[model samples]
Target chain A: MNDYLEIFNLKKVYPSAKGPQTIVQGFNLKLRKGEFVTVIGHSGCGKSTVLMMVAGLSTITDGGIVLAGKELDGPGPDRGIVFQSPSLLPWMTAKENVMLGIEQVFFTAEKEERELIAEYYLTVVGLADSMHKKPGELSQGMRQRVGIARAFALKPKMLLLDEPFGMLDSLTRYELQAVLLELWRKNKITAMMVTHDVDEALYLSDRIVCMTDGPEAGIGDILEVNFPRPRDRKAVMEHPDYYRLRAHLIEFLEVHAHKKKPASTVPAASPAVAVAA
Target chain B: MKETLRKLDFLLLPLLGAAVITGLWYFSSATWAGDLPNPTKTWTESKPYVLDPFGKRGEMDQGILRFTWLSLILVAKGYSIALILGTPIGFFLGLSKTFTKAFDPIIQILRPVSPLAWLPLGMVLFAKVKGVNISEMAALFTIALCSMWPTVLNTAVGVRAIPTDYMNVARVLKLSRWKTLTKVMIPATLPYMFTGFRLSLGIAWLVIVAAEMLTGRPGVGGFLWQQYNALVYEQIILCILTIGLVGFVLDRLMSVVERRFKTA
Candidate 1:
């Protein structure tokens, strides 16, 4: 399952008043099947631009993505997306919102089966009680739960998240992270998440791809976390290597991510950063 | 008890307002040679029309109910025609900039022109459509053409106001254009469309009264004109109440639908 998801030399340029402004350039990543990856960067670092290209929701000015064996031409149900805000249809109940995506993805599935699928995922996200409530009627956390439920119900080949909990409070964020981690472990679906929180990346990802700030941003360093599976956050935090990795990521974000010329990082297999004095 | 009181608050103000208005109306209309009929006088004068409201009392004397129904039918047919034509055109105008650029100016210019002003055009057009001199067709055309503005404009505005994030959600889901329209555009625009509908119905009601008065049609508006010509002040007052009450009911109906869709 190597190269299960391949993003090669991706670039994005927006038409501006002066001229075309590049947002993501030479951005690259590869994921083996079932590996959870998170792209971490500062605001305006084009992490979302990168994830959007993978989701086939944005125009790819220069590069391409190959998911499994198929090239992504445009948006399809193959890639599920969970956005930062609760982007559920305000008019539809949480259950109905999930059902809408499921119906679109599995158009041929029986109505009863689709209802069951929506119910199963909503229940998974602890939203079974609120599933019948509309987006406006639910709390932000409950709304995001519906969003996560909708994406998971699609059962897509890959899930792309655009800081799915960036707006939530820290406590709510932690609760949602646990729910998401449990779901990811159960399904083992290849996923790429965009985030700013270093702890969040370390908590959820098997690999962390840190990115530099962009007019043309690219990957700064790829850090692999080899902590054992069915991991406990408390146990992981107590481990010395976890602190090492955490400090490593924070440094990259502060120094490497902001410095703009992080293209000189060591090879991907080095497992360490060694620059000449 | 608190919930009951809260509900009662809604009706209290309206009832008080109505009572005040009625008191003023009676106090004014009770004066000698005021040339307006008091409520009691109108009720007494309307006893024949009210007792047998649907009666076939000769040609000019078709009862109040029959006249009201005829006027209502004209408004319904004309308003229905307007909705059927206006909504899609408005939606397309909202979605397409070029279409709006070309068509919107004409719509704007035509929108504010009073429904009464369209009488001449309706008369000319319906005098004989393809050599067919149709009775009541002219007034119907005038009513329809005049009242179609609100739904069209409001629907367009509704489409314009849809949040971009919702469209992004639509794209990420890869929903079909049909689904995007039905699931996104229609529901999102429903409240706005209802606003337009209420306005359009009001305009249609106004236009129907004026149109029927001129067309010599057997309706409330025509009846009002006849009673005016015969110097029957009480019947004229009754006609005013009939028109006001019906208009209020029509507006209320639309608002109910609006509230349901909005809060849903």
Candidate 2:
């Protein structure tokens, strides 16, 4: 499959009084159309920095990203992002928050059509009952649900989720994971989610891109998961290779998470490691 | 029973305060400030103006309400002008660091200036214009000049305080400059703007009395000044009380509006 989204030689550097501080260097990734990819690593691994760069919320200091054969410029409705926090407008209702993006993406559509689009997505995210509530009035999980609904309602070519369920409880996280998977299964939009959650990466993504810990973080390893489509939590957990794959992910994280190396000496290892078949 | 007592206390406390203050005033007037009329004497002397607020006898002897109405008109005109001018200046200040850096010192210097000082400048400036009410125009100019700072400062602060997350959302949605401003910036800045407006209106009301006193326009402040010159201290007191009451009411109205915006 041709690459639907390509990020090449990505680098982020911030100037400091001491010297230049390099956060991420020589990062590269490619996603085929409709691929679900999650970048996982320890905290402060610059995973989110990479995601923000792709989302065009952060400036790219070096390298480039090309999505759907178009060189990315800045943030646009073509790319939808769900931030770590819900980031919904506090004054706007849940439906209004979703409609904010929908109105921009579907500018040519009629008002009723836009309303329907917002309503449909909010309902899909299980916010049908509280669609009129503001972010302040909603629970943390429900707020993130609105955020998810907002991103999906845009119907963008790519979705970038920066730990969308990071603030939620485990139960809410599981529920949102189901909601996200259901949406992704239906839409099959190319997605890149940044997370530190191991099981979350395993359950949701086709490929898990792990990064070495930062100040100058790069892709430490890549693991492919080939669990059957429309995966059930019970069946996947019960699968024979589940613990093996889970062990491999945990082991890779433990080895590379705290190990810092100079950027010049680190080789760019080939990342096409199919750990599961 | 406890809740009812608390509610009663709300009304009773202020009434008690009024009574104590009136007693103190009567005592002070009887003792040291002998020229200052007692509360009973003030009410008697100012009764016609208080009871018949809308009466029209002559230009100078018109009802207290007529003078108050005139002062309110000037304040309304000045406050409106202040909002129209100050709101955009505030947005610019909030949006651009360069603009703020250039103008911030100037705003700070001008913000503390009294309406008394502005009144003379207004008179001199409007003195050049043709066929306009010089005193009224000077008074309006002074009120607007003095009152606009709160609105401008508050609005700028409000704009600057918009969450980075909201801006990120705007960028991700690729909203147009206009849409981003109208949808995100304006709504986010509204509560702050109202706070500024509330303060601005308060300042405008405060400035109007001083402005009217200086310009000798027929308003509450002018009435006070006129009564002072005429040796009718009771009517002066009446004007002062009216001004305070009106100011309190205006502030309450602005706060109500501000609260509505905050929750909306």
- Highest TM-score: give the candidate number: 2
Report model 2's TM-score to 2 decimal places.
Answer: 0.94
In candidate 2, position A113 carries an lDDT of 98
lDDT of 1 by residue, A1-277 (tens): 5889998899899888999999889977899999999998776677888887887778899988899988789887788889777777888989988988898888899999999999999999998788888888899998999888888889999888888888788999999999999998898899999888889998889999998867788998999988888888898788779989999988887785446545444222110110000
Model 1, TM vs. native: 0.87
* lDDT tens digits, residue span A224-262, model 2: 889998988888888887899899988888777436654
The worst-scoring run of ten residues by lDDT in candidate 1 chain A lies at A268-277
Question: For each candidate, what is the lDDT?
Answer: 0.84, 0.88
lDDT score for residue B163 of model 1:
71
lDDT of 1 by residue, B1-264 (tens): 988978898898799898998888788877754977777888999988888889877766877888899899988989999999889988998899999999999998988887567776778877766765444777788888888889899999999998766887788788889999999889889888988888999999988878887777778998999889888878887788889988999889988888888786
TM-score of each: 0.87, 0.94
Worst 10 residues of 1 chain B by lDDT: B126-135
Candidate 2: global Cα-lDDT? 0.88
Which candidate has the top score in lDDT?
2
